[model samples]
Target: MIRFEDVSVTYDAAPGPTVQRVDLIVPEGELVLLVGPSGVGKSTLLGTVSGLVPHFTGGTLRGRVTVAGRDTRTHKPRELADVVGTVGQDPLSHFVTDTVEDELAYGMESLGLAPDVMRRRVEETLDLLGLADLRDRPIATLSGGQQQRVAIGSVLTPHPQVLVLDEPTSALDPAAAEEVLAVLQRLVHDLGTTVLMAEHRLERVVQYADQVLLLAAPGEAPVLGDPAALMARSPVFPPVVALGRIAGWSPLPLTVRDARRRAGALRERLAGAEPRRATPTEPTPAPGTGRRWAGLRRERTAEALPGVVAASVARLAVRRGRVEALRRVDLTVTPGETVALMGRNGAGKSTLLSTLVGLLEPASGTVRVGGAVPHRTSPRELIRHVGLVPQEPRDLLYADTVAAECAAADHDADAPPGTCRALVDELLPGIADDTHPRDLSEGQRLTLALAIVLTTRPPLLLLDEPTRGLDYAAKTRLVTILRGLAADGHAILLATHDVELAAEIAHRVVILADGEVVADGPTEQIVVSSPSFAPQVTKILAPQEWLTVSEVRRALDAGGGEPW
Candidate 1:
């Protein structure tokens, strides 16, 4: 139902075309997944379906693009509203209304659907996405996952023939992501809808795609083929596929189950072998620095409490209107600790992060960061103790150019002039210094926000969904920076749904459920034990101790030959 005939697009800002000579067809009623590294034109490709490519985005399209027998060249986004629904990476930017229910209905209203039909679809979408409880909540007040659901629901309510999503599940927790994908499956199988989705979280959606559309690189022709076939050679693939390649499995497994069945011998070989753990950079001696030999030794359980509490939340009761976002939530992070906060969507993970940053006041109980109450501290004084990179990175950025933002960060924190700029280089290499912050890709924006927050070098750092739009390379850079900070006596609490990331860098894991703390312990203890939270390697080598592809490679390098 979607066809791209020699399509090429070039934006006004950048050199050359981001997408070029992309000729492909997506059959009706099938789900096509767009896979590629960040800034490789995944979003730019999706924009062509609804005519957002050369229309709203102000780009030049060199070839024809059609959807449902309608040429997008002739149909603007407003004219094609009934045929295609598009959700970009940033959900907040897509929202035109304030409340959840209103936002869901707004699209239909714009399409001029009858009130009765719109209401019915609105209710159906609310139930389908578990947004019934949040129907009336203001969009701005909802958590990132909740906002993601609302953005999706708003589009789904239109009942379009084609649905385009960019990183649809990046903000969602495991179960909620499953729900969204399940709904898409139903749409494709039962309703004969065509869904074209672009996502960085391949493990969550690869198993469900009817076909894979691989964008090799800028100015390179795109490849369309079977999911497993494309994944074997693709740089951007799920961890399960990587594990399959490592073990020499035929027809590389797209899902964990397929890999697990072929993992018996590999599991046995790895049972006694230890994977290489993440190592922190060399210590930079500073007062209260505890990471002299970080990552070399596992955190000791002998001490009930670690030294120098960076932040603590005790009996925290937080409410957002009628919703009890957090109930009696008690958590703590010590200096040099890197904790991963995890849970299903609407499970109070974001709420907990907000509480840490003093954005939300607990209804009851006490909270402290660096021995000072967050909400009670002044803005000028707060930066020294805590810094937060919010789930929506755009919220933290306001300046026009990347240079201006970094310079502002340096000035704001009283740091050296080039401190933030240097951090930006370390995190997002090759990005132009003078580019507008608004023009950068989602991953680049997140990196800039992280740099800004790190400029202050607070003892405690809180990041919500730090890897949302980051490619593996960018994500690797972020992991290295975070590890170094933790080694330099910094405490980090990151809220994320990326299991692989959590497994890679997190020293400990804390799981929240229904507004309460459900599980908290060492990273290996929490993630490797839970099926839903387990990383790809953990799934394949279940009953063993492996947690990442790097770990498997490490075990193999330590003299364990191929099990097969």
Candidate 2:
């Protein structure tokens, strides 16, 4: 149904083609997964399907691209709307209406469908995506994951023959992600629809793909083949595949079940050795004192109380309009601790982060950071106590160029010039200073926002969905940087749905359900018990306490031999 013939794309002032000589055919009624590292033109290649590359994005296409027998060169995005439905990484940009129901119906209305037909399709999509409860809620009031579902439902209501998605499940929780993927599976199997998806979180979707298309690097020819064959040599892959490689499996396993089937001996080898646990980087806080260490001391009068808890929330309640987003939530963080806040979509994870960062005022209860109330603290003074990297990275960026943004961060934090730039280089390398923030990919933008926040050097750091678009390599770099920060006596609280990330970095995991704390404990105890929250490694090595690939590697190295 989709064909690319000798395709190559280059921008107005680029040195070479972003995607060079990409030729492939995706059969009808099949799901094709596009896999590659960030900036290797995964998004650029997807844009060619709907004619968004050369036509809408102001680039040059060297060869022909066709979808459903129509050449994209002749058909603009609007012209192909009847057959192609595209959802980019940013769902907020895809929205046109304010309410969930209206957004879902907007696509059919644009197609000039009858009112009855549009209404029926809208209701069907709401049920399919589990958005029935949120149908009446305004899009602005919904959480990030909720917005992602709405965005997907909007495109799905039109009943197009072909669907193109970028990072479709990046924002969704484990359960919600499963629901959405099951719906896509039904579309491919029962309805004979063609799907071309690009995602960074391979663990969630690799097992479902009918075929895999790999773009190894920029200006390199693309490879299309079976999922297992390509995954064996692919540079970026999920944790399960990495574990399979480490154990030297003949055919790499793509799902947890396959890995578990082969993990018996490896688990036995690890039965005697326990995985290393994440501990506090700084000295533990005094017993029952509720006061953190004075590792990052700043002189203050008696009123300032420089030595205090990194973050303390007691009997906290927050309301958005009439909805109680958070209810009587009590939590505390000390210096040199890493805590992960996890929950399903609209379960009040983001709401809690907002309250802590002073973006939302608590309806009732107390919120103190470094002995000062966040809501009452000035923006200037709050920077000294805590820093936040919001879900939407664009919210923290305002400058026209990357260099200007870095300079702005340095000035705001009172740090020396180039401090933010250095952090950016370490997190995501090779980004030119002259590039506009809008010109960057989603992963790059998230990294830049993180670097800017790190410049402030606050005692407490808050990250919301920090790994939304990062590939495995970039995520590893991020894990290294975050670990170093924790060792330097910085308390970190990150709100994320990436279970793998939590397993790799979090010392403790706190789960919230229906705006209340459901469970909180050591990382291994909390994640290993919950089937929904466990990482691939933990699931594969069940009955064992392993949480990540690094842990298994370390155990084997210390023992000095492979199980097989």
Candidate 3:
């Protein structure tokens, strides 16, 4: 059990308390979900439970927090390791060993557990998280999602009474996320474990939570209540809940099953109605030509953009060490298209992105971006054709402050000064220029990295897991920005596990599996057919093929009521 008594946290030279007067109790054997917009102190509040807030983060705590009869104020994180296990947003930062098996056993070793006991827990965790196959793989060689599982298993192996997780499933694919969440449920129900998790992807975890905690805004008093009651008024929510609100369903649904149960009449209402035609922004005109480019049109598609291949891959094969990461994959992107690359963990999605970005040389076949082979193109020349924002945003940022990073981006892209800074401000408002990049929240850092990549305005842009840390509002801003870029004749290829994002933004979806293309087609066609990949809206209104809340709202609005 965890208890927060009059808790308030403030840092040096801060505007105000990050979390103010938060008084609550988390009963044992229950799962509590902390929900809020980014930077509302969700991470800060979680840190208080593990004593990472005022102890290691150099913040001032005004009240007390106790976990399992042990006062966090008196016990440091190491001292509470026996009862508490914490996993932050960045799994790479949580590793202390080289291989998956070693990392899983490291915590128990630190706890001085018997070797036999440690081995048993390690094996159980590996199986529980679906990490058995990856147990022997080095952490550095694993995919982002794989690393995430290893990080989680490391904490779970210690068999702590309390688990505090931050965005636990952000990097996982749909099935993997389900497995991890199910394991957490088992812990809560069968083993009497307490889980306090903070996540931005409410769609994946809201249905699993026993209770909901809402931190509406900075310094605002927190609200604890039933999940349905909280979701009805919560500013940030999953697409299923949003759809429920639109249908005027009593007791807003938290899961796809709940939404589908009440969707029979709504399905009939939309039986004959088709999703609204998307109207992407018109392409900007050429320098001397008043008309739009011949390669693009108002309805952006690859067919319209003839002879305007932004990126082309033909029978591409890439090998990492001895592993065949990608195998004979053929794909094409045109000037005005947004393609989402989707798959499970180790499905070669990231491998293909890396090949396009020229970070990993293809073992065979060809990879061309803007008519030049990406592997052979010089960095300076490549900047004119393509740009990449990787999964780990920190890899693209090395500046001491946000200002310096933006200035460097402008210089590297040969753009006017302050161009990159303006993009950052647009994507995420109110980020101070003087702030260090390392001090930023995960979502903030990813936004800054995206702004840096966007500075070039390259013809082909590739993003890996772009929505990892972004909240719904920030993700909306991002969707608008990306859509505008596509309208401007920029081709975007993003490898992601965020199905909702693909539903909202992608014109097409391509799924890869075990280094092969498994499915590729229009977003509606591909996502609606696959139960694992479908978004909440599509699942709720099955047999209708609707993919997003926006689509349904548009259909209803355009029809002016029931006849839609």
TM-score of each: 0.92, 0.96, 0.95
lDDT string for model 1 (1-564, tens) is 998999999988678998998888899999999988877899889999988888888879989898988898889999899999989999989999889999999998888899999889999999999999888888987888889999999999989999999899989988899999999999999999999999888889999999999996777889999999999888788889888888898899998888888888888777777766543223222232234223222232113123478899999999988788899888888877888999887788888888888888889999998877988888787777889998878888998899999899988987768788878887778778889887788888999999999887888899999999998778877887787777766788998999999998887889999999999988888998898898888877878877888778877878656766
Task: Put down candidate 3 lDDT per residue, 200-249, tens digits, no spaces.
Answer: 99999999999999998887899988999999999899999999888898
Most lDDT-accurate candidate:
2
Worst 10 residues of 1 by lDDT: 296-305
RMSD of 2: 4.1
lDDT of 1 at 492: 87
Clashes of each: 0, 0, 0
TM-score of 3: 0.95
Candidate 1 backbone overlaps, count? 0
Instruction: Tell me the tens digit of each residue's lDDT in model 2 across 1-564.
Output: 999999999987778898998888999999999999999999999999988987889889988899999999989999999999999999999999999999999999999999999989998999999999999999999999999999999999999999999999999999999999999999999999999999999999999999999998888898999999999989999999999999999699999999899988898888899786667545232232222212222232123334546899999999999799999899998777899999999989999988888999999999999877998999999888889999899999899999999999988887778888988887888888988999899999999999999888888899999999999999988887777667657788999999999999898899999899999888889999999999999999988878999989988999997776
Every model's Cα RMSD, please?
4.5, 4.1, 4.0
Positional deviation of 19 in candidate 1, in angstroms? 0.9
Ranking by TM-score: 2, 3, 1
Clashes of 3: 0
